[model samples]
Target: MKIRDKILSGILLVLIGVLLGMILMFFRQGTFSFDLAEVKVTEVNRSESPIWTDDELEKIDDRFVFKTIAKTVTPSVVYIETLINARDRREMSPGEEEDGGNFWDRYLPRTRTVGSGVIITADGYILTNNHVIESAVRDGINVTLDDKRTFDARVVGRDPSTDLAVLKIDAENLQNAVIGNSDRLEVGEWVLAIGNPFRLRSTVTAGIVSALSREVQIIDDLRRIESFIQTDAAINRGNSGGALVNTSGELIGINTAIATQTGSYQGYGFAVPSNLALKIARDIIEFGEVKRGLLGVTIESVTASTARRAGLNEISGVLIIDTVEDGAAAKAGVQSSDIILKVNGVAVSESNQLQEKVAMFRPDDQVTLTIWRDREELETDVVLEEMQPIVQETQTIPENNFDEEQLGPEPEMWEEIPGDENSGIEQQSFRELGFSIRALATPEDPDRFNLYLHRVQRGSEAWNRGLREGGEITEINGNRVHTLDEVEKEITDSLKNHRSLTFKIRTGQGTDGYYQLF
Candidate 1:
């Protein structure tokens, strides 16, 4: 009986312990339920419409025109992204040189620039600005279409003179823009600017043609041809190489630049005419280079003063300042101080107009120039010559080569000459001209001193007039300057006489550019 009671008590203790553990676990976990929740969903009404209104289908309004242009032209525009290596990196503005920066910044590994391009061929021939992809690395250009497809692009050719370049891709059946004649485009006509501005893809803006044949002096190349179509369209940095089309969705120009002080759109925009762009594109694709015809004459605008001085009946031509020796113009009996009244029967009042007209032809092509000489108009046939490339050797001037004491005229020679305030003549100083010269010594003839520009202050009058550092000054005021003294003397005499000073300069790039200072 006693053994049976002990076994029963141990069994009871084990059962109680197990029950206590279960209770503790239930208390820690709080509560539990066995429930299955059900979901209930209801359907909404949906339908399709096939009805159309005659007003919506036939009535064409300004909004309809813009919508049609956007739908037709947006697909033709593309986004271009380029990877430029450090060695080939250049400033965004060609006319502006990179002057100040940390040494390490110059050696950055890589940089990227974004712009836009227009498809010009069904097989993926794209037209863009030279500055857009000029120095990109090999296999670094990526073009994105409106459909979000991206492809690698290859450069077909580039023309720095016109700031135009052609690109090729592997894609086919691309949407291409229909090019229209820019010559027929007139001021006050409605136009559209299409581009990927500020990374906003396929942006379209509307404006009117503000002006024509404008020379803004933005191109840095001495042979640069800048006869841009000016407009009030809003264009930003990334809009370079984009398409400027008419209301009919015809491509009429290539958006190139903007006149902005804050680096954003402020009303003014410029474009390369489609006529010139198409010509350059065709040449680049056919010959791998722009076969530009050279007229062999340096010309300027015939202003009222110039017309009065030359005894012209009207101010309606370009003044021929000089002619290339043995060139086509010289061979055709063209002389300095003559006025070019018309080119091939087209009246040209500005130098840019003449340049644009002549740039349309090829080498060996003949052009008739209506020239005014000795108060009479005479027609002369000038066969355009093949343009010869200007080869320039990068010249490095030795530090401290200029001796301030030995070069330039005495300070007393440039005394401030007071001008009559009543006559509206303002006193001008030679020192404020923004440039200085020094005598360069050559190994061939150490005794023969050659005048070279020492420094040209940026944003100064001289710089804006296309004077740059390291340029060789061959002549000043039509007089050959072998020494800095001659340059100083010529400049002093001109400043004192209140006359314009003409400088014949061989630029650092070894191209000849005539600069005039008032």
Candidate 2:
């Protein structure tokens, strides 16, 4: 029996040795028919996606390959040339219009500014920075393609909220930058900054997306709309309105601003999120204006300090400060003290987050605002409001109270004339601060104020609203503006919206003081 057991054990050892030998043969002899030789035939059919080109693939192996990538992506990028007629002082006295200090400078272009833009559409809709058309006072804006050809550009519309402007050049078959999804962008993702930095066309710089939704100062407006994709790319003056593209040359952002005290290229740069810029540009092209939704709530970021003060268990989310009276917030029951946790289930951390969310809506569209109130979370429906037309109030001579101390030159022919009897009516309180007006005494009670209709200049905000010579603003608004100071304060306070001043007025004595919301 012992001999029989030994024989079986020996057979088992022999079987194990044979299995080991088979395994080694399988690995050494192109096992499973998937060796490198077979892999090549499979790849030839698909081009191995992305790295299909030898140069692109070789760079990936090198770990320091941005040149080949940039060269391939640079052509689709565009260079924007802006013919800015920036209204600036040239050390000239009262009556001298020194147009760029030369004969051609006067009649020809005064300020020729060249920047960059990404041609988003093939048919000539160029995406650029609002500051690229910076002045909003351009005599004409021109576009020069990657090709040397130049085309006259038209400002379709500008969204100062995003610092994006869409220009239309009458050219077809134009190369548009590839568009990318910003939602897919992550911190430390590779991105390329391509533009005419300091007027150098088609210059490309490489960097990574250092951050997202970083609030930086792009302008001086009280509203801090600096929710930008931060990158370490070398962005400079002429780079404004250029393209911040991905490795594939897809447009992801419109490079708009930089953080340099010397006004030159700094390590950091900002870009208008292309997703937002495109949304606004499309609207401007189709409807002549950006239709961003209004939530009517003033929001602030919940910092650690604010989070503790506000009793927030977590130190993130947006705090609702002031809900405009009778506006969307008021209607939505969003009170001043409530903290906003999210919008439509998306967490909001700052005003820019809320603003960006709201901007996504169209007028009349409803949105759900998630808020924490009294230690309880609640969701409220808010109806988005249309952005009322806001025309900038320009500087005008105040007929009523001219600030003689602050006066510049008044069209030289104008010296102090003997006070005309009619001048008493022009001496209203608000006249000297860049607005024109007249005053009248109420006939019913010689002491009471009356509607004084006068012809305003063509470019005045009142004129833009179609104010006529015979129109009488009867009231100063909800308040009485018989004095010019009252009128000025009310207008200045509500400069952001379309609050018209009403005058209790009629064409004749039967009328009363009327108002006009300028």
Candidate 3:
């Protein structure tokens, strides 16, 4: 009886061990399936079909335009939240690199910022501002749709010059914005700014287009393109990258910035026009980059002084200051001081406007430029060139390295310019003029030693008139100056006559402008 009892006990113990092993295996397999399962969200659907026919949209009552536009656009504009980890600078200790860091670091504090985005396609391609998700960490972007569904977002591409970025989510059949022609937007037209303002989602504000092609100088990049549509819409924080729709429920712009003094709306808002935004978005989606075409010339707005100097009858068009060697404009016979009256027959009065027009095209695309030179209008066909990336030119003297003699005049002082044998540079400071002058040592040779403005005092009359440092003094009072003495004599003569000094300055950026200083 004792041996039989021992055998039964051993069988029972083995059965209990087998039961425990099965339970453990079941739980492990359940956890793996729950955590590692793939979701069906990877397909991208790109179509050119319109969401709603014009006739179908036109059937709506005129009185319901605002409400219809709001309802249709709200679903396309999404709320974007980004998490930027604050522990980016935290160093991992010994034996911590295997799992990335200490376990506690995973729960470290994060900085969160909110913005908005517009769905440009049905497959979940989104367009927003670069500043919105510029520094977001890996897998840290969460997008909340109008229907309250959330998904992780991935960056498609970014264009800092345009302040634009593209993102993608694992979504399909999403409501997309109906893009309209922004070039046809007129001043005083009714428009709506729709976005999440101050964390308030789906906020809409009504306003009229106050201006067009406004260069507010808000973009921080040197290669920035600013031809914003200015409106009196109430755009505040968190409204960035939102949609600015027209009465026809069409997307006209992307709400970008507000001209405010108290951190709220003060009757001014700006947006990137839809035509440009759409082009940028498509480029990013197709090529993973912004392929901007270049005119290969430095241009400036044609002011009254410049118009008069260029012998123009009216203050209109953009002035070509200088042309790059072998550039599109140069190859097309576009000369310095020529006024660009129109591009493809569209009048461009500001540099930003011209930039926007050219930016709409790709490299090798030909454009017609109506130029005003010698008081006559002439048209030339220019093939747009690829924009060259900004490169730091290697020179014997660094840009900021200064010498004592290169400093400016009596009341105001400027940073210096270092001399080098390779440049054959010489400088002279004119205290009476509030600036210093520099030139090549071979002053007698016009080609070798063109006079350059080494320094100009801050707040000086010349500086205020746009006579900046590193400017080549090509001409003074309509006469070309090859030597420093000639430049001084012309200035003295102008001052003696009590006349405003007219200077033709060619800036380091290769833009030429005429400035009048008294």
Candidate 4:
């Protein structure tokens, strides 16, 4: 009986051990049964395998790229503050003497303006917009570096045509910005604008290059060079002199202006291309001023109508309206009505682009201009000359006492004609052209008839073509037109013949001038 009981116990112990082993195996594998069909195994071909797949390598974070650029570029941008003398306007009692106003006003008040700039040289050469330091008072220009070190800055030179200026700070070991090739920048490429906007230092804004070779006409100077890089960056008044850099943290442009109605960012901002800005900066440093080269020709963009008139196969290139007498273009045999297609192998489609391209060179630099005339493409080598400063004399006209009605009965009869239809021109309204002229006696010389332009419409073709109010027309189509009848007849004949009407006129300053009415 004892032996049988011991055998039962041994059997029970063995069964319990076997059950524990099965439970442990089930927990380890997380299943009681294994199915080969439920498993997935990828096969590798070592001969065709790459160390890393293209998709895996391309999954770089954009945040890392932007952060790297910011880290590299922000150190080169600086803040500029200018102090200008302000004019005082204090009202005085009526009985007070004029001396009272003059004495106090002589003590000019100081006004502070803030801006941004980029360091281009390690030795402390900085580039900024001219307007930032235009009228700054003596000993008032200040520059602050990234580390908050402030120093007094001196103006090296300024070029108003390009709205650029160079400044120098008395500092060494500065981080200078790396300039990139602006010509290689394309639309849709990412860019960053760094500046002190609204007095906020180290402000950064990101955008894409919206366009290239844009002529915004923000600069009021007649010789303004505006091949701007248009961006959607949020640039404000204080950002005018800041740096517009690429993803590589290389400077490509200088933020200059914004297209806004509220004096703030409204989606459109413009920058001066780095190539042109650097050229002007270098010229200023070397010559103490901008050494601009001139082609010496008045040019206009080719429109469809202009293309038809000039007999061009395509509506492109800049149309040379007139060549300056004895100038580089005239000496190069460039004639009026010729279309300039290229400058130094680069195609130019606008008058401003041609102007900018030529302005990039110094005086006496040789340039090859591709011109289209009589349906033939001709290459002409032109040695540029230094552009002479245009000296314009201001004239103030006195209010006239003579009435239009008193001088009018004959003028009224002339006005009865259907001026628009008789000329057989389309969309050519005399008013839309932006000028109104009246046949009047030349007060200085009554014997000579003069057509005085009393009203010049703003933004009109005439206004844009540089015609000003108070100018006098002396001839039409190269013929002396002393009377209104002769002037009308000449315009009618030219329009009927599909010829552009040329005018020989006198400016408000009594200087002789030539203009074309198309």
For model 1, how does the per-residue alpha-carbon lDDT over 289-349 read when each residue is reduced to its tens digit?
8898888887777767678977887878988888877988999999988999999998898
* Model 2 CA deviation exceeding 4 Å by range: 1-72, 89-109, 136-139, 220-224, 391-518
Which lDDT value does model 2 have at 174? 73
Worst 10 residues of 1 by lDDT: 391-400
Put the candidates in TM-score order, highest first.
4, 1, 3, 2
Each prediction's TM-score against the native?
0.69, 0.61, 0.67, 0.70
The residue-by-residue lDDT of candidate 3 on 398-428, one tens digit each, is 1233553556344535444556757678677
lDDT of 3: 0.82
Question: In candidate 3, which residue pairs clash?
Answer: 321-512
Best TM-score goes to which candidate? 4
TM-score, model 1 to reference: 0.69
Error of 3 at 431 (Å): 17
The C-alpha lDDT values of all candidates are 0.82, 0.67, 0.82, 0.80
Better model by lDDT, 2 or 4? 4
Clashing pairs in 4: none
After aligning candidate 3 to the native by TM-score, how far in Å is the CA of 33 from where it should be?
A: 80
Per-prediction count of colliding residue pairs?
A: 0, 34, 1, 0
